[model samples]
Structures are given as structure tokens and as C-alpha cells.
Target: MASSMLAPAVGDIAKEFRASDKAALAGQTSFVCMLGIGPLFLAPMSETFGRRKVFVVNSAMFTLLQIPTALSPNIASFIAFRALSGFFGSVGVANGGGSIFDMFDVHERAPVLGFYLTAPLVAPSIGPLLGSVIVRSLDWRWIFWCMCMLAAFVTTFIYFFLYETNPVAILQARKSELQKKHPDVEYEVEGASDESIPKKIMNASDLTCSPENGTRAVKILTTQPIVLILSSYQALIFASMYSLFATYTDIWSQPPYNFTTIQTGLAFLGPVVGFVTMSTLVILYIDSIYNYVARKNDDDGLPEYRLVFANIGAVLLPISLFMFGWTVEMGLAWPVPLVATVLFGASQVSIFNPVQTYYIDAYAKHAASALAAGAFLRSMIGGVVPLFVGQMCVFPSTSTRRF
Candidate 1:
């Protein structure tokens, strides 16, 4: 939400700070770039220390960082703080799939996973909508202030309510407890350090950040073909989605349309509607498909069974893109192009939910790392694509359609 919430206010911010176009855009790009990068390290760290600890600590940091961002004196400072916030704020993205994997079996996972995945997919569209209202009525910095308040609430909820779900972390804690209770008996946890009780207490790092465990995510990401292919496909979808988001204001606010900031933000509802509608369908039917297919295959489910909806998404994506591009180029009624975004949004959820579920099924134990690998690539491309979108908008229709 914080990543692209300022889209409607970029021009306002540029005017106030006398910043270049690129610098203003960096307000969005810098945050997104770190969102990709942070998961690479944080996801693996979750495997070691535990998901709850990583989530609580990083979420608090992400919330606190928003203060400096809201009060930033210059574009450079704003971008720097926003980037830091993104890094810390990515805990959910880093470990959510792993958490889901810990709790659910394959047949039960699809609906839950589909619902979980909607937060990231739908939040971006909603961010701009709320941001436009805030930007219209309040100062641009208020956007970050709002984010800080929301983050604080979410962080508090997490600390109080969320429990440790990682099986490895749970076993390690149990082993530590058993060792303290029965000094004569050997209590060992696989993947945990064999440090003395005092040493483990004195130096949590040895227990929590083992070198081998820390590097596991990197190894899986680098060595696994399934992870690599799925991550690449996810990256492409993210990049394309963010590219459209980056150019949305430019497309609707100019020339024939002449939309207000609020109206421009409301335009994002097209995608929001699509996301909600398809997410409903996915939540209802995805698990059913998986179970039926598994039954046909002697109750054994391959990760590839998750790809059923992805085919539908792939087909919808190109048609929607072309429809959106040509309709806007022709300067048709706003609804025509908005319908394209609806299809785009539906396609996005259809692909994202299935692919993410496949990642968890394929690497159940290492799901966090697998997701992090995919998120790292997805966010990197999503971040970079936006920087070029402004330039791309300058080209003629013949060239722009290629986007």
C-alpha cells in the first residue's frame, strides 16, 4: 500500500520539492526495489529464528520508519526512508507462504492461499484510491502518516495474536526447554546449533542465525529449476501489473479525460472489482479442482495441478492488454478501457494464486525461501518497470502498444 500510494501525488510532490520527474517517481520505485531485495535475506532468516519474531520485529521497524518518511525534508530523504520501510515491511511477503504451508495440507491449502495472496494483489489498486482522497484533502506527507498509523495497528495485532508456526523453530524451542529441564539427557534439534545452554542464551545469534540455515534460501533459489521457472513467470506478471499502475495516472488525467486526483484514484476500482470477483471464484473452486484432480491420480497431487487456472490467466492477459491499449489509444469512453483493467485484475489473481500455491506444494518445507526467491525477482522487475513506464508513455501508439 505504501509502495504506490503516492502515485496520485507525484506531481504535487515534484512541485513542492522542485524535483525531477525521475526523482518523484523514485518515491514509488525505491520502496518497491527494497521490497524485492529484503525478502531474499529475511525469508531465510525466518527459517532460522522463526517467522513470528521476524514478522514482529521487522513490522515494528517498518512502522517506525514511516515517521521519518512522513517528515522527510527532501526527496532524497523521502526516498531513503521509504526504501528502508519497504525492506522491513516485506516480512509478510517473505514468509506468508511458508506459514500457510506449515498449517495446511495440499487439498486444504488452495482456498486459504488464494485468500492470503489477495492482500498483495489488491492492496496496490486500493492504495492509489485512498491516496488520491488523502492527497486531494490533505498534504502528501499525510499519506505516510496514515501508513504509520495503519502499520502500528497491524504490528500490534501481530505481536499480540500471531504465534510461532515454523516446525523447525518450534522443535528447537522444545529442545531448549527439555535440555534445561533434564540436564542429564541429550536434547538435540536438527538444523539447530549444539551450543551449551548458557552459550545459547548469551548468544542468540548462534542458535538463530546459523550459517548453513541462513544460506538455504539462496541455495534453493539458485539450484532448483521449478523455483526458477515459476519465479520468472511470477516476476513477469508483477512487472506488467506495476507497469500499468505506473502509467495509470498519466493515461486518465490527461487531455480528453481531464480527471481529478480523486477520480483518477477511483479509476483503480476497475482492477479492484476484477480482483475481488476472481478472488471469490478462486477461493470457492481452486481447492475443489485440486482435490478432484488428485482423486483422479490415485489421491496423489502433483504441484502442476495448481496450473489449471494459470492457463486461463495467460489467455486473458494478452487480450486484456491489447484491449486496454487500443481502446485508450482510440480515446474511447473511459468505461471501455476500464473493462480492460478489470480483465487484467482478474487475470492477475488467477495466475498469482495458483503459482504461489504451486510454490508451497513443490517446496513445502522451504516454502518461505521459495516464495522469497520469486518475490525478489517479481519486485525487482515490478520496481524497475515503473521507472521506464513514464518514458514509454511518450512514444507513439505503435511503440506504446508493444508495452
Candidate 2:
């Protein structure tokens, strides 16, 4: 919504721009659809090209494409660039969880997953906050330029540090290094030989080829309960969050409290404070609890223990929602509702981290695939929720019906 909020403004820049609505919707659809489809091809390529090269190159390419979107000439150009941005960028997002597993053990995944989970929620919010300030202070073009620069920075960082964590590739590199040191060394480091390519191809074909793809997708859909239940709950939670964003202005803008778009946007600061507070609390406590649980269980490090945090979030969420609902419904002071909104953010992040991490843990080997599917479902809600945000307050159905 942040990326595309100015899309309407972008449409207005040219009176001949007939494609803004369709273009923006198409752009989001393309993003969500491409993410679902990319894995079929990109995952297979991971074997041939190797992980480090794929991520490092694609990350840079994805980042670079934002430049064209920044410089787009019209509606068609805008959608086209946005779609390409999502396409090239999908590679890192699609494969990143797998990289985390390669780099960290189950026990050590807490911090890394926290960072990943934080980035999407926090970055989008932060991106828009900065983007809005820039748009107000400068031009919308700065948003894309800023994105391009950030991407370039990350691309440079990745080139310096990202390496082949694939066991086969690393071992081969080690073998080659040893060979350089010992000219006559005949020691064979067990390795996958190029001669076996055909057999590996056959296995790969059976596993992921088009003929098996449909059944595998269905099988995964049916088997992964975490993918279904947790993702659906996440979608609902997001829908509710956005509904609040939409309806908040209605309550705030009435009776000597009417606010400008900028003020309404700034109203989001309360929710941000809530999210940061909850995120900090959860991140800090989860580690201590993980250690405590590890010691209590004699160091087996079970993932189910994360649910204790999930319960805390569940309680906080409903409590915050009710507080927000009635506070606005009863026409309590504006601070009452705003404080409740902050509480909602706090409750959300508190519950958000551990549940997602638990899902990854339960589906460890297939964590990327699960997270991808869940991410798609969640993104859909984030995209669609705003459409209803505009309608929530005016409906006589329920003054607080939005939540």
C-alpha cells in the first residue's frame, strides 16, 4: 500500500494515464503469482548454479530493477517496472530461509528469524514512514531512488560476505584448495561427480518436474497444517490491522478532531510504538525462555515451547481489540482509542514472532516452501484489506465493526 499509495498520485501526474487502478492491482497480482511460480524453476536452478551465485547475482539484479520503476514514464511503464522488481527480487526472499538453516542450527535460529520477521513488517511500515516524509519533503521519485540505493548497499554487502554454504560446493572448494597446497596429494574427498549428472537429473525430474508438480502442491497443501491454520489466522490478523488503519481516521477526524492526511498517517505512530515495544519484549524474552526450556528439558531444545509465547500473544490480541473497539464506539477521548491501538500493535508482535518461528521449526526441511506459501496468503490480505478500510466507519452496521 505504501509503495502504491503514491501510485494514485503517479497516475495523476499524467492526465492520459488510464492504467493506474488496473496497473497497481496487476502489479500486486503479478508479485503474488510470480512468488508462487518462481520456486518451481528457481529451486531447481539452485542445484545447477549454486546458492551463493544465485542469491548474490539475483539480489543485485532485483535491486537494480527498482531504478527503472523509479524512472518510469507512464502507467504501463510503472506496472511493468514494479512487476520486474518483484520477479528478480523473489529469488532472495524465496531462498533466504533455506540460507538461514544452512548458516544456523535449530537452537540458534531464534535471532535470525526474528530479524527476518521484523524486516517485512517493520520495513514496510518504516519504508512508508520515510517515503511519506520524503514525498512530503521532496518528490515521490525519491522513494524509488532510496529503495534502489538501499538495494545496492545490500547487494554490495552480500558480495562481500555471502558464500557457498552448500555442503557439496564447500567440500569441492576445500578439495581444490588442498590440491593447490599438495601437488601430488591423491586423497579423494568424497564428492558428487559430473558423471552422475544424468542420474541426478532423473531424480530431480521425478521430484519437481511438471508431471509431479500438481500432486506435490496438493500433497503439501493437505499435509501442512501450520501452513493452512497459522497462515489463515495471520491473514485475518492482518485484515483486522488494516481495517483499523482505514477506520482510525473516521473516529479521529470527527467533532473538532478532523485531521489532515498527514495527521492521520502520523496517527500510525502509536501503533508503531506498540509494535516496537512488543517486538522488543518478545525478542528479548524468547531467547531467555528458549535457554530456560533447553536447560529444563535437559537440552533437547524442543520447538513446542515457543507456543507459551504464542498464548501470551493470543490473550493480548483479543484484549487489545476489545479495548480499541469499545473505546471508539463509546466516543471515549481520542487518547483512549489511540492507546488501545498501540496495545494492539504490541499484542500482535508479541504473538507474531514465535508462531512464525514455530511454523518454521515444525516444517524445518521444507521451511522455505511453507514460508513462501504463508507469505503469499498473508500478502494477499495486506493488499486487499485497504480496499475495505475506506468503508468501515460510514456503515451503520457497527461503529466499531471494522475490527
Name the 10 consecutive residues with the lowest summed lDDT in model 1.
Answer: 200-209
Give stretches of model 1 more than 4 Å off: 195-211, 395-403
In model 2, the Cα lDDT at residue 283 comes to 68
Could you give candidate 1's per-residue lDDT for residues 1-403 as a string of tens digits?
8888998888888988899877888988888988888887787777767889999999999999999998988988988998899999888898899899989987788899989999898999999999999988999999999999999999999999999998878998898799899999997787776657455434432323343544455566678887778778878888888888888888887755768888899999998888999999999998778878889989677998988988888899899999998888877778999999999999999998998898889887878878887888788888888787777676344334333
Superposed by TM-score, candidate 1 places the C-alpha of residue 301 at a distance from the truth, in angstroms, of 0.9
Compute each candidate's TM-score over C-alphas.
0.92, 0.76
- lDDT tens digits, residue span 1-403, model 2: 2333342233233444565443444544454445445544444344443578768877788788878877777767866776667656667645676667667887788777766666545543444346446666777667678778888888898899888775655776677799899979864645444436565445433454242231233245456785677767777776677556445545565643456546655666777787777777776778778778888889667777776677776877888899977766666666877788787877777667787777667766555555555555655665566664554455333344334
TM-score of structure candidate 2: 0.76
TM-score of 1: 0.92
Count of backbone clashes for each model? 0, 0
lDDT of 2: 0.62
Supply candidate 2's per-residue lDDT for 170. 70
